[model samples]
Target: MTTRTSPATSGFGIEFLGLPGSGKSTLAGHFIASARQSGLALDTVRAAGRRAMRQRLRRSHARFRTLLTFAAGAAFLRSVYPVSKYEIGAYNRFCILHPELAHAALQAMSLHAADPARQDKAGKLWFKHCLRFQLIREEQGDANHVVAPEGFLQKALSLFGYGAEPTLGLETYLKLAPLPAALAVLRLDPTEAARRLTARPRQTPYPLSSMPPDQQFSTLARWAELQERVAADAASRGVTVIDVPSHRESSEGARILLEQIPEDALCSQGRDKRP
Candidate 1:
């Protein structure tokens, strides 16, 4: 099939989002490898593992500075909650100084994390907030295209799917959240996703993981339906939703996925720079 394309005018990020077992990450690996082999300049992180970041933060000098930054940021957040019109403006403009940190903090506030919640809810909310910093920082850099196996789009799925109330700021986030340059969503049906989840060696990631197999499958199906609906909404807001048939052969799926990204987006992200 001939895939349509749109080239973004500036640096942009591409994110892959799908059911936990839908092969989103694996497909991204194949897609990146194919793009590179074909001579496309694709910018990808060499190592995204947690251990790498932990090692960096372990250095005494680095650790002290990092902890200081976190503490300062946290204090800033506490002082401004119940945001006034003026403070909110200040918060927004802080992006001029510390863009990604301000960006993630504001997004978390938009999700109503400033309000009280149960211990579990607070944990989930802040966990996603920390991740938002990474995604925003990477995108803010001078890169033609940065690819994330899972990013804001995927986090939206988790926030929406796991919450007890379906309307709990999800629609608001969907409407106001910063959209990535390209979003690849796995188009597998829930039944297929459930089958793969059950077969995979990794523990299930769903809240229903502890439930019976029948319940788990049903939950996956519901989540899959929500994902499709959310993808449609994102498309309406001008996000390029690359529908990947991940239930098919990974090579074929990756080929189709890469084909959809515009030629301009394939340029090496910061790889052409000469220091």
Candidate 2:
């Protein structure tokens, strides 16, 4: 098969999942620099930056309490998002292609429903402003190497990180979510991660970095355990999993990653074993 190539047409989307302070951002930085210097189409979305913070805030109870603070336009979310405004057609087509996701709650996401599915779809709709944007873009066949710090693969941690044990939903999401061409897991010692998080105390964007040391360690362990399970599930389906270690002296982990998984394979925009 002739592999399609276009700067505007992405061959693939890469997601990096790991514990906080596990050097995902570092590897991503190296990757962005190299890919761009070499002139690869790329867009990197931080795991939980201001954009996500604002999006989550909109869906959170803080919408009212901190409305004046984080509302930055959108008219305090008073803008009525009727079912039509969303990209339902394309999403419907996607369902046509992946009939598996179409059934079950995956069929969910209307303007109104009796239970949590409605809220779930509503939140997903709003959150589309950032990382989810990549999904829509991908569905359009838009080209650009999209790199996510933490996204669909790691969403279980987000859902349950607040203290709810995930049951069926975890497997459902992991099974149904689109498989990226590559899923990279950054591995780092929990103690080192805690040390890094503690050192970066003033970075308000990441709450884990500011949590008490004990809590940070425990949280890191929990995240690691959950992500390992998720990665195993993804790998079982033939998705390439990159295990990136902390950057050692004179060693750029990104280079090793690229070496193991060719750049061409990542930008190909199709799923199969890496060439």
| TM per prediction | 0.63, 0.60
Report the error of model 2 at residue 185, Å: 1.4
In candidate 1, stretches whose alpha carbon ends up further than 4 angstroms from where it belongs are 1-12, 41-144, 271-275
Show where candidate 2 strays beyond 4 Å: 1-12, 45-126, 129-131, 134-144, 204-211, 247-251, 262-264, 268-275
Cα lDDT of all candidates, in order?
0.57, 0.54
Q: Model 1 misses residue 238 by how many Å? A: 1.1
Prediction 2 TM-score vs. true: 0.60
Clashes of each: 0, 7
| Candidate 2 C-alpha lDDT tens digits along 1-275 | 22222111232367777776677767777876665555454565532223433544455444355656655444434465432222344355445654543342233333123446435744564344223343445443532256766555655555434333433355665566655667778776778867777777775223464467787688677777787788887677666788876745214777666666545445623533233
